[model samples]
Target: MKRPKFFYLIAGFFILAIFLAGCAGQKGNEQGKSAGHPNVLKANWQDVLSQAKGQTVNIYLYGGSESTNNYIDNWVAPRLKKQFGVQLNRVPVNDTKDIINKLVSEKQAGKKDGSIDVMWINGENFLMSKKNNLLWDSFSPKLPNVKKYVNQNSPAIKNDFGEPTQGVEAPWSQAQFVFTYDSNKVKHPPKSAEALKQWVKQHPGKFTYPAPPDFTGSAFIRNMLYETTGGYKQYLKPLDKQTGLDNIVKALWNYLNAIEPYLWRKGETYPESASKLDQLYASGAVWLTMGYDPAHAANEVKDGRFPKSTRTFVLKDGTLSNTSYLSIPFNSPHKAAAMVAINFMLSPKAQIAKSDPENWGALMAIDPNKLSSKGQKQLNAIDRGKATLPSKVLANHRVPEIPAGYVDYLEKGWMEHVAKH
Candidate 1:
């Protein structure tokens, strides 16, 4: 019953082919799983919605702005509840770092089910969370809306302050740095860093920025650094902490030092936060107030927090622009609900609603070209209030943010060289 050598060889070949085919199938499954875990990556969109029903997702965000809080509470919350059967619980944190700290603590304690489901995060905070393994693993790519509407190749989508997002965070909104001033007070506003410095010298006690570590203040410093260092080209790569501080940041310190004596309060102290800086501008203590939110001045004008003549402007050399993102904590108790909510937020309907000046006034993160005709019309219909600069203006003057590591170096250098000096 022994087979001939040719028959034996043929049988061996068939067995080897089957084994290799089995191995390939297994490898393909592994690759599929690696793309996104099955728990968050459902077989269909309906499956995600079905599992998300009746779940309460807690979203932790910076609740500094009453308008932002109201928008979430009044608009987004109700929509999620009605459409997805998910209760959106808005957990207001004074700073995103508070949430990151809590997540770190939970991770250290080996907690499987953490309280925070979704968080508003970007830049240094996002880098920290991702580095510390505090964020969920690549769930953003699983969302249908993101896959369809988001331009994944765009730098704003791919990178957060020069650090790769790796699909862990979902972009929520766009912001650009802008300075606000009363048109009556500053007849000819400074249009570049050199002009701003000269303006400060000419109008001493009239201009100041928030101390570093505050997002807006940090941005102002970065802009100055870019201006002095011949435009942000040299600082785009991953930072070599001490080398960058010594070689690149020395110029920044020198620039700040030269301007220190002419700064408000003779550079004796800086406003603690952007809100405090805004207060100074409102009370006529300072002529210049700046923020990452370009629409903020418009909102302030409407609310009568700022004068009717208050207007927003960017530097001629362009100002930093970035997209803020939402991410899930690593140990979220309700992953499905969080995914459903984030997907909904990325929808054209939600983006249009958020673009309204009365609501949040954040720029749409979704590309208009990808949107349907109805969606495009709704987005276009939003009246970008009188105080808000035109979209084309912002776009023309937009600049990229330097890497996140540079932030800490700049802040520390400011404290040592400028604040202490």
Candidate 2:
């Protein structure tokens, strides 16, 4: 049974190779399954706070607005670091969808350790993340600010598009669609879709909108659709429940084409995005530029990006409005820090700064009435700048957003009906 010396040496070498291969495989498997386990659930606020200190949290958001970038970078980051000993890193993205996509990839690769601590997501992007189970568990209810300042039962707080948030995301800001025009150039701004069409024809080559798929352009269609087909009430329900969708959408197409001929370049092309259109308006190449943010013109004016004469208006019929939110990713390694950051952002102090025109001029998501008399006084004193409308004016013209499903449908439909046509 004894083997030759050379034979035994060869056998030992083969066994050693198998052992090395097994070790390498195990190491690879571990990396592939590197899950983020911040484990903030079942912990008290104090415990979470203690754990969060000295941690760095990354917040991913659309970086289109320089004011927003500065607000978070300068105003918010310092406060978070000073108060909680936590570092807030800003990870500006071109699209919020990219965060969901990144999380989805991480999940597929069995990577539990993900980089996105929090994301500024809403509407269709939130719907997609929820559908794919790309978000972390119910964590918002754990925050003291949510319990104190937020109305838990309001439909606006409960839902994102049509999907229930169920304590997964925290409401951060409110946005309403508004058209920005140079007051010196636009004597009488359009009040409705028909009026807008007439104005476009009269002032040929003086107006243009960002192409559809751009957030601002997509919103323009949705606002006009409300005026043309009826109002937003019909679209409040789920997409499947609504009927005669095709015929209803046809009216929107006609309205768009009618105005297209009078667009800045004769409808042969469009500004690639809202920012591009803003640049055009700033330079007086176009008379109008529009955005979902009511205070956007004010911020632009403060930054000298838009003319001092720029003013904002919503369609007399109605203006589309919705809430944007922050949520932790499913595999975020800094769950405690993420929760702390979100809670702080929801606090009255942070919201007031966000609402200030000098900072970002974003609408406060916090229910202002929920604050005490002193808190209310502080909030009321923040002048939202001249180009921004009063709260009552924006709220009076405000209309609810359609279900996210409908948003997707229109984005695709625009390509077929309007963009190509």
Candidate 3:
């Protein structure tokens, strides 16, 4: 009887150890999701949507463009509210670079619950944010639209200014460099950097680009760097990796300086902002203006801001094309809602609405070939207006952007080299 009692006691001890082991394993799995996101990554789409409902996401972005502002306020916000039960509150800043600086400050202050849920970001801002680890985990891949629509193999999708996105940002819209001219004033547009220099010399005080540190102006310099230097392919590597970069930039400064005397105000002063430049063009103070938006000239015409003769043209060699993205902050309290919002923005239906010039006139970020037959038909149906170039023409001349470091270097160099002299 004593031996049988001892055997039962041993069995009870063994079972107790097994139960404790299972509990420890369960705790470890819970701790694995330590980002304080409440398991957004592991949850299914339905669960994410359930968590996103009634969440108000704060979207920070550049608020200068009237169409961009109207699109967010009137179109995107209402649809997001009705469809997902998520509220999108857009916080506009004069510059998006400030948003990056704010995130850096928030991180240093050890603020665990940041207010920025999603931000419209790209280029040097994205680079700085990634360096500081201010972005949330690899959340882009988890977005259903990105998985279905975006081209997974494209180099542009994988990298931002040569920095790996690592699934931290979702591409929303694409814009390319195009010169806007009033056809009544100018019969033929220049097709290359050299041709533009001659056009300025021949038609003095009729053309001018906004000063640098201005986003459009800075892009203008980058495109010139490619045209003046041997094409852009050589500069695709990191800026530091480029040999004789100091010497290569001199040609750009020279080209710009050569055209300085013929510029509006004789190069003594430049329109302070792209908007100011656009105003000059509107008032007929200048006959031409430029921007990253290919549809910009067309939209201006439709809005009665520009003449009906307004037309857009790209360089013969190549034109700069950049994609802007939506990113989630590291400490965002509503990651689920941000993801849901970004995913919706990437969808075919939303992109189609955004593509209409009356809406936003932005080019859809997703590939057309990847879309369903119905979706592709809708995208193809967008008029894009007479001022906007055909898709095939823009596509043929598109060039990938140089790394951000080069952009920063060139923007500063313009101030020292071209602006001062």
User: TM-score for all predictions?
Assistant: 0.89, 0.91, 0.91
Models sorted by lDDT, best on top: 3, 2, 1
Q: Number of clashing residue pairs in every model?
A: 0, 4, 0
Of candidate 3, the 10-residue stretch with the lowest lDDT total is 28-37
Total clashing pairs in model 2: 4
Give me candidate 1's TM-score against the actual structure. 0.89
Candidate 2 TM-score, true structure as reference:
0.91
Tens-digit lDDT track of model 3 for 1-421: 3568878899999999999999998876554333334678899999889888888999999999888988999999999999999999999999998999899999999987788999999899999999899998888989899999999678887888777888999999888999999999999999898899999999999989989989999988899989998899888899888888889889999999999999999999998899999999999999999999888888899999999999989999989998889999998878889999999999888888888888889888888898899988888888999999988899899999988888889988999999888
- In model 3, what is the error at residue 125, expressed in angstroms? 0.4
lDDT value, residue 113 of candidate 2: 82
* Residue 408, candidate 2: C-alpha displacement in angstroms: 1.6
For 1-421, candidate 2 gives per-residue lDDT tens digits of 8779999899999999999999999877664334322356787889889888888999999998888999999999999999999899999899887888898899999886889899999999999999999989899888999999998788878888778899899999999999999999898999998898889999999998888888998998888889888788878888898888898889888888888888998989998899899889988899999998888898888878888988988888779888899999888878888999999999999998898888888998889999989888988899988899999999898888888999889989989998899
Q: Any runs in candidate 2 off by more than 4 Å, and if so which?
A: 1-39
What are the RMSD figures for all models against the true structure? Answer: 7.9, 5.4, 5.2
Cα lDDT, model 2, residue 238: 88
